[model samples]
Target: MNLSTLTDQIEQRYHTQAEYPWAKFPDYAVFRHQNNRKWFAILMVVEASKIGLLKEEKISVMNVKAKPDEIGSLRMMKGVYPAYHMNKEHWISLNLTEIEEGLLFELLDESFSLTIKKPPQQRLHKIPL
Candidate 1:
C-alpha cells in the first residue's frame, strides 16, 4: 500500500494524532516529502545480513529492506534488536514489509506505550492534577 493509504488506515483504526513515534526505531527511520503541497511520511526499515537462530534453527538472514539512504545511518551495537543491527552475532531485522500490518501495529503500539511509561525529566517535578 502507498504511504497515504497506510496512514489513512492507521488513523482510521488507531486514531493516531501523528506517527513520527513509529519512525523512532533505531533501525527504522521516517522521511517526509512534500508532493503537490501535501505531506507524506514513509516508514522505511533498513536491510542487513546477519546470522541468527530462529526457534533454534541456525540460519543466515537479511534484515529488513530499506531505501539505500535509510540503511546507512543505523547505529550498531549488541542486544538492540534480538542482538544488533547487521554486525552482531545474533538477532535480525524482520522486514516490516514482510509482516502483516496488524502485527506491525501491535509492535508499534507496544513501543509507543512503553515510550510514555516514564515521565519527561523536565516535567517530573510537577504532579498531574
Candidate 2:
C-alpha cells in the first residue's frame, strides 16, 4: 500500500496521526502509540542503497517493529527488507509501493500491539490458610 493510504488506515484504526518532527527531514513521518509514546512505524524517503536495493534512486519505505522470531522469515518476503535505519532483529523495512495491503496491515497491527504498554498483573496476598 502507498504511504497516504497506509497513514489513513493507521489513523482510522489506531486513532493516531502521523507526526513530522524533524525540520531537517520533513518527509519523515512517525506513527507513535498514544499511551507509551513509543514509535510503531516510520514513513520516509531514503536512498535505495540504504535499504540494500542495488539501484541508486530514492525509495519510499516504512519501518515497523517486528517480533524477533519472525524477522528472519519476514526479511525473505517480497518487498520486505532488513530495517534500513532501525535494529534488524526487532524492526523491518517495507517497500511501500510494492507490499500487498493485507500483509502490510498485518505487520502494522503487530507492531502497534507489540509497542503498547502492558498492564500490571494483580497479585493475591495469602496468609496461612
Candidate 3:
C-alpha cells in the first residue's frame, strides 16, 4: 500500500488524523493515540540507504512499534527493516511500496494496540488505627 492509502485506512479504522509536526518536513506525518498522545505510526520519505537498501533513493516508509519478541523475525521478512528514527528493539520500518496490503494493515493494528496506555494500578494504603 502507498502512503495515502495506508493513512486513509488508519484514519478510518483508528479514528485518528495524521499530524505534521515538523515544519521542515511537511510530508512527515505522525499518527498518535488521542488519549495519551503516544505515536503508533510515522509516515515519511527517507533515503533507501538509511534502511540498508543499496540504492540511495528516496522511498516512502512507515515506522511502527512492533512487539520486542517479534522484531527479530519481522526484520527478517521482506520490506521490513530496523526503525529509522525510533527505537529499533521495539519498532520497525516497513516499505509501503513493498509490503502486502493485508500484512501492512495487520502490522498497523499491532502498532496501534501497543501504544494504548494500560490503566494505572490502584494502591491500598493502611491508615494508622
Would you list the C-alpha lDDT of every candidate in the order shown? 0.36, 0.91, 0.91
lDDT sort, best first = 3, 2, 1
Cα error, candidate 1, residue 122 (Å) = 16
Off by over 4 Å in 1: 7-28, 31-42, 48-94, 117-129
CA RMSD of each candidate after superposition: 12.2, 1.7, 2.9
For all predicted structures, in order, the TM-scores are 0.34, 0.91, 0.91
What is the Å distance of residue 69 in model 1 from its true position? 32
lDDT-best of 1 and 2: 2
Give residue 22's error in model 3 in angstroms: 0.1
TM-score of 3: 0.91
Two-way TM-score contest, 1 vs 2, winner: 2
Query: Relative to the unseen true structure, what is the C-alpha lDDT of residue 115 in candidate 3, on a scale of 0 to 100?
Result: 96
Q: How many backbone clashes does candidate 1 have?
A: 0
lDDT per residue (tens digit) for residues 1-129 in model 3? 567877788899999999999999999999999999999999999999888899868999999999999999999888899999889999999998788778888999999999999998899898999
Candidate 2 stretches with Cα past 4 Å from truth are 124-129
Q: Is candidate 1 or candidate 3 better by TM-score?
A: 3
User: What's the ranking of the predictions by TM-score, best on top?
Assistant: 2, 3, 1
True-vs-predicted CA distance for residue 107, candidate 2, Å: 0.2
Instruction: Identify the leading candidate in terms of TM-score.
Output: 2
